[model samples]
Target: MKQSLILTILVTLTSFQRASAIPFQVRADLDSCLNSAGLTSIYPSSSGYASAAQAYNLRFQYSPAALVYPTSENAVAAAVKCAGSLNVPVSARSGGHSYAAYGLGGQDGALVVDLSKLKAITINSDQTATIQTGNRLGDVALTLYNNGGRAMPHGTSPEVGVGGHLGCGGFGLDSRMWGLFLDQALSARVVLSNGTIVAASPSENSDLFWAIRGAAPSFGIVTEYKFKTYPAPSSNIIFSYSYWSTPQATASSIFSAFQTFAQTSAPPTLGIQAILASAGAPGQLYVSLTGVFYGTKSDFNNAINPLLTKIPKPQGTSVVTYGWLDSLVQLGGQSLNTSTTPDGTDTFFAKSLMVPQEAPMTSAAIQSFFNYLGNQGTSSDTVSLTTLYSMHCEP
Candidate 1:
């Protein structure tokens, strides 16, 4: 009786799998539909398909039934309509930086709407700019800077796409002062799931505007974003301090002091990050604090001196002043004149948690973290725990 029951279960599972699979004929039908919609950049599971599915994270590798590159909003609408008509799942790919590689659909046999071809940036007369969703942060920064010394707060990674980044509430060096990337956004143009194009703002499609601000991927395909830009600061003061320590208590002490400083003393124009890593001698650890201040050197020194006194002694320290664009290069770990493509891709898994502002970092918690790191076999693979000072800013 047991053997018969197991056989029945296996047969049922196999049947369900087969039912869900996308057959060759179905894929061909979808491809034909996409091609018929006037999309010339369509790629099926042959010739250029592999490169079309590449993502910033190597771990997310999925081959969609069809990948369509739509150059204009009309083209995007056509692709969406055709995908819906054919009953094929669809995903939008901008900078292809989805952590789980969701830009290509977490599973197989979906249609990917590749938006990399739409790269237009128009600066309005009123200090506002209309940016296409396909523009990467690096390209956006350089373009804005070169055009009029304008800037916007965004993620540190230069390769992050404006669509998914702003859609998910982007934060970066200037975030503490200017707020998130979404906060600067005045409006957006989105293609809804029903294949209709709509403008969303505070006064138009207000509900959709609100929903798309933070929950964008679920709502629609963002075609473009209009943002209010600010005059770029003339220069930035970058500083770094590092300490070597094997004891968990030392790490805890440094973290506790840094947290207190970040909460109480740090100004909005100052951005600081703390990194604890097992990159020292075998079985040892180190702590590093790095930051950038978007103000005069004198003002930066005055504001950071008190915090420096509270932290433990650093084994080394460095400080430098740089122009606005150059400072971004330093922060992004890219050469001054390098292209905007992402530096590299890697295979990794990540987990995250949000700690409340009022909560304290106790020594016990720090020791537990250290213990966990110590047990993760020594294969020269590095592990890092990073903390950034983030506070709510008025929009």
Candidate 2:
């Protein structure tokens, strides 16, 4: 009797598995998705899917089971619910500016929810900017700049998405004077994991609001962000200083000096970085300190000359002050392209670290890292380096 009962239970489980293995359920849901008039504005067919699959970081491509555009938070919620009901994975894409694999890295047979249609900026009378998740930094900056020269301290690249940057603690030229991008954040509208839309602000949903300010991406997909804005200066100056190192020892000294200058004497108006390389024909053991200053030439020179004196006499120095937009373009190393997000390309691998001081081990680690680059057969010209310097504001 025990053996017979066990056999019946096994048969029942096997029958259930076979019944659920078919795609009929998925197909029915997909048919409904196709007929989703509510999603007609956002859902793209296979032909449309090809273009949407392109990502800013050109490292890879994503092909989703379906592509839907969410015009509003409600639309976004609807799409999320649909995906959940169908038991499909959902990947949210705002400006498609993810540097790593997170943006379009959808699992197999997942729904790629694209939020490009939600690009809108509403500026209230009180100097607050409410931007949709899909808005790019360039557009927002230009708009604010035109509206009485207002600006926010943000990344040097204009094509970056406000959503991605704010989500990850954004920083750029004005970071030292101001702070990380998250510092200016006022609030956000986010969709929870369970398909509910909620407003997160300091006064309402305060815990979620705090989480939204720094780590919204990890917790939920934010649809809109509100930021505090300020009046921007008319023009700015960018000074680039470069030096050649005949030996690795000189390179190490230059790095150490820059570290001391950054920690002890650096000014908030100045943005600085130290670049190192080989000497000779191909050029190795070279170091450079680059800067972007927000003040006048005289004021900037006063702050920079002492710093310059610490390193070897520069082989080349260039100073150009222009309209803020022109200055931003030069900083990004790219001409302005309106159709696509700025600095959105899948061409390189980038990693950043925050170090308080430079030590022998720091130099050794960098040398080792560059050595590994050689092993990977990477040329020096193709590699780019960025070093950040931070200083505390006066009490």
Candidate 3:
């Protein structure tokens, strides 16, 4: 059986009501309209309201006027139209996995358009897929593998919603070879702010289509996505080696060696990433090199051996091969199912920058960065720096 899970929250006005906002009676009217339009799951401040308002990041929490679940696109349109009529702000929630909790409005008093119930996966005759925005990367990966040994390049986190991930450019283990998730999108069905449904693609609504490719949440609620998929590779190999910085072998030396390997030895089929972090030991820093190669174990080892020889002595090393579905599970670092709830939710602040492939970091700059990292305390709350090197065409 197919499964669709939608979680929408309408925060109660409670102590946060404002005199300039819509009246209580108008809010009730909007609720009545949605319920009449076949939105069966409506939660006020009571009932599953707390859980409905929770986001993947526990840091930001806010309540909406009401939580709703729309089973179909028409039901979504109805909720939007009703909210517009009542002058109530609406926010769309798909998987509720936004790090900043944007699905919860980052504030309060907004109707959340939960799209979880829209989950559906249809494999077409062509090498393409019609996927509902509510599906998570994990569910999508597993489903594609099961149906036709197909796969889409997406983020490692299985809990990330297709709506947000594809909307804002997705990067994954195989991204170096296949490309980002947004590059796979062929077309989309979106609900405009005025409660109108429209199709966006290169041939139709070209401007909206281009805008939604990267900045989706700003435009409207996306109901469905049509994506190009690739045939699953027969096998994938994951390799990792961890090194502890010491008097003889320093983090600077390791980073310099990594930059050389990445620039000289890395291939398109191999995705390389490095992390400089303290492994629960104060004043002790460690550098870890991890790679994913989309090929057999022998080829992976052959490609990775020379680079390993260039780096410092390792505290630990591991290499394992996995099938397509198993590779996604390992990449996610968690077991994922078709549940609407996200797994790996925590308070974190993240930032990333893109560097030109041709320009490699200088050894002095690498040493400086490692010195700064070394100064940071090795507390549980300490922040770590992770660098990913993926080679592909500019999107």
**Per-prediction TM-score, please?**
0.89, 0.82, 0.87
Candidate 1: global Cα-lDDT?
Answer: 0.74
Backbone Cα, N, C clashes tallied per candidate = 0, 13, 11
Can you write out model 3's per-residue Cα lDDT over 1-395, one digit (the tens) per residue? Answer: 11111111112121222222346897778778887887865555457877777767665667677767788888888888888888888888877777667776666678888888899899999969999988888889888888889998887888888888877777776776887798899999999988999999999999999998888888888899899998999888887888765432276787677667666666668876776665445446777788689998788888887787876678888888888778777878776575744455565544444444465666666665555555543533444434344321111
Q: How accurate is candidate 3 locally (lDDT)?
A: 0.73
Best of the candidates, TM-score: 1
- Model 2 TM-score, all chains together: 0.82
- Give lDDT tens digits, candidate 2, residues 22-112: 1556845854864573784322344565566665645545545666777778888887777777777676776666764355533345566
The best candidate in terms of lDDT: 1
lDDT of 1 by residue, 1-395 (tens): 00000000000011111112467777777778777787865455367776776755665567677788899998998888887887888888887777667788667777888888899999998989999998888889998999999999887778778887888778686877788898888999999888999999999999999988887888889999999999999978889988766455566677777767766777888877776666444446677888789999899999888778987778889999999899999998875332534346655555444455566555577567665554441334544544453421111
lDDT rank, highest first? Answer: 1, 3, 2
**Candidate-wise lDDT, in order:** 0.74, 0.64, 0.73
What's the C-alpha lDDT at position 271 in model 3? Answer: 75
